[model samples]
Target: MENGNKRLAVLVGCNYPNTPHELNGCINDVLAMRDVLVKRFGFDHSHIELLTDAPGSLVMPTGANIKKALDQMLKKAEPGDVLFFQYSGHGTRIPSAKPGHPFRQDEAIVPCDFNLITDVDFRQLVNCLPKGASFTILSDSCHSGGLIDKEKEQIGPSSVTNDGTLQQSCSPKTIPFESILQHLTSQTNINTSDIGTHLLELFGADASHKFHLHPNELDLSESLKTDEGILLSGCQANETSADMNPMMTGGKAYGAFSNAVQMVLKDHLGSLSNKEVVLLARKSLEAGGFAQHPCLYCTDENADAPFLWQPQGSDL
Candidate 1:
């Protein structure tokens, strides 16, 4: 069933344990996605891998497991291979352990065990790939956009103090900028520069305490000039993507973006480009009255190309 010219794809999803919410809510979506790729898109099932929270399977997304998977892919993947990485779960920012290091914070994807695959690990994985292999990463979780923040905005409102001095008011709803600065300053344990540098590269320079737009305008194709990578995030760095109850739709919960992706790939299989896919998905969500923006951040110059899957009779 292999298509000699088709690319490989690896999909991963996670739902945490012991939490009221399930971590693998989107596992089915990923499975469905893989099916579409294989049956309609010309991909070989052997070329597609799925990792999830299913029992007795590969341990759910530990840092080591992520690395192991990457290593496996690197070994088998060759130039011109189109690689896709999809993740659905929680995202966090942890304080760094040392001072003067690049990152004062660390970003992560929460695994089933509550451990994380830090951004540091991701960068290393990306850097290790062979040139000319294209990567399209889709992350459905909070802070996914941290991989692309560029501008800075004050998180809390500014107020006038008693002495007529403009000061930031401390309130339960307001996050103080100083708190973030202080957290960054308190590191004395682990070296965090590399993590910090990676954070800045992914989330932008002002990621400390300010919410900023993800630097999404980067020419994905240009950055990976060797024809290798692209990124499509669920939300901007400063925003949170919703994970709603799937049972409401006669199933379990799924992130809003995940649901939309399924809709497009299933309904409009042959006639849409990635850009059209994103637009339709966004419109569908908005028409349903969801107040979220399903954004598409692509580093791939050819991101506008037609989808890999298309119905018969479609022009190639």
Candidate 2:
């Protein structure tokens, strides 16, 4: 069943092997997602870009490489096309540099090389998408709930449990600010307290534009109102997603949220709505004793929209 519209995807998983921020299951998460896209959703294999930090990987999941892949996908996007981005890695929260920023903190995904891609970067990307195009992001990482800045919250802390209790047995996939500062300090030999300055020095022009913006110029109204982007975050902004190893799952290592989504999709016969998927996944996580709550950020219309386009529809 081929949908008339084109489908493209960028999948990134950073295991950060042998590093202080190492994880046991990111690579496996994205690989499983790749299969799901191709086999279940009819996404062409050639149109999908895969990036990882696994040994001998052709393209590393560095910040520069990830941005380039996303740009390429957007360039190839036409109205009515479907685009997807999946990140299974460590996500960090940095104190907002701009004075009086509403959120007070900026959420980011950690690349293999430690160059961070912040929420603003994703907002800009969503703004660039063609009018009739749709871009769905599945971020299976900690502090990922608001990764796409200012998107409407269809399902979030208000609708779910906001108790902020973390399961003691679960391994969280977040890199602390101190760890990031230490790593960047070692790399650039600069002991500055500001993460933005360290990012500017290390990546130069390639660093996130968020770090370079003047405080007074930080208006995101346009990016806030986008109808083309949908985000399914692994956990609430204040919660940590679990990294499940074989010892915990008695099988292959993987992200608890990622595995929960896969299970929901597999158990269903027809396509589930975006909101339905999150609700079901949240249930699965709760049943498994994991504390992280999956969230969906998108418009009300998208909340009812079928997850990524149905296998037999032209809506993509």
Candidate 3:
């Protein structure tokens, strides 16, 4: 399974256009990631698939479209291939289906069409990969630390902060949940039909649907104990990721966590391990006056693996 193979990637970014929850920098975040993957990671331009909310784009970052893109990326995966999935968007939580989860809320990524993809959905995707193919995931959104439902955490913040929010950003002008609802409401044409659908799916959908509640029935730990997939999350499940004006570049907006990752990668040039990336990104965020901390989720052995490990591959 370790034979030489090419690289593939899927990148998604959403800025919730013309809505109350509009973010300014997600598209820019994805563009930055594309740059690093092309210039530094040895990925060919033809092999990368980008889905964003930018104008004149062929693909949009809706739930169905995102799932389809991921399926395409995984369908052709092979041994020694470098597979990557990157998301720079809003992340939220809904009521957990399991009583075992203390917070009673399951983490999800906010897509353009409001089909909210959950952690279980991502875990299912990770499970589909072959043993020798390295699948690396980077999520630059709030509450994304647990997007791969049952993945082991090697570095993270305290789970005790489970109020489904960040105390630092709970100001009167920035209530994220309220903003999310307002954005969803804007999509409804006349009646409250869209919101009703969201409520129905959140409260009444069958377990087979992707938007269903936390149906984490699989033993992801044992299944992926030695798997090569790794996740670098923007924050803990209870925190918020910031979309600040890019003071460093001073033009477009960018997610703090995404910018930090690119910064670390540029500085280290593949010398850092997965845990080192998280720690360095944490320090970078703190230095930039951000409250959220980056996190790393992988098995113990993979924690020491290179940031985006590839079989028999070396980097600059």
Indicate which candidate wins on TM-score.
2
lDDT of 1 by residue, 1-316 (tens): 1112446777777655454445435576577678767666666788877777766675666544654666677677765566677777666555543345445554456554433455444544555556666555667766565342221111111121222211121001111223323333354333344334343433343223222222232112122323333445555444455666545346555666777787776786366765676677666666655544445544444456554424366332
- lDDT (10s digit) by residue, model 2, range 1-316: 1233899999999888987678888999999999889888988999999999999999999999999999999999988889999999999899886677656877899999889999989988999988788899999999999998889998888455444444444578899988999999998888788888899999998899788887665574487564779999999998889987766547787899999999998888687999999999998888887778899998888899888886764332
199-300: candidate 3 lDDT, tens digit per residue:
444434422244343346433234555676688999888777888754455556778888898888878754578889899988787776677878888888
**RMSD after Cα superposition, model 2:** 3.0
TM-score, per-candidate, Cα-based: 0.65, 0.93, 0.81
Native-referenced Cα lDDT, model 3: 0.73
Give me the displacement of residue 40 in model 3, in angstroms: 0.8
Ranking of all candidate structures by their TM-score, best first: 2, 3, 1
- Quote the lDDT for 138 in model 1: 68
- Number of the predicted model whose lDDT against the real structure is largest: 2
Between prediction 2 and prediction 3, which has the larger lDDT? 2
- Model 2 residue 18 lDDT score: 88
Residue 94 alpha-carbon offset, candidate 2, angstroms: 0.5
Model 1: lowest-lDDT 10 consecutive positions: 166-175
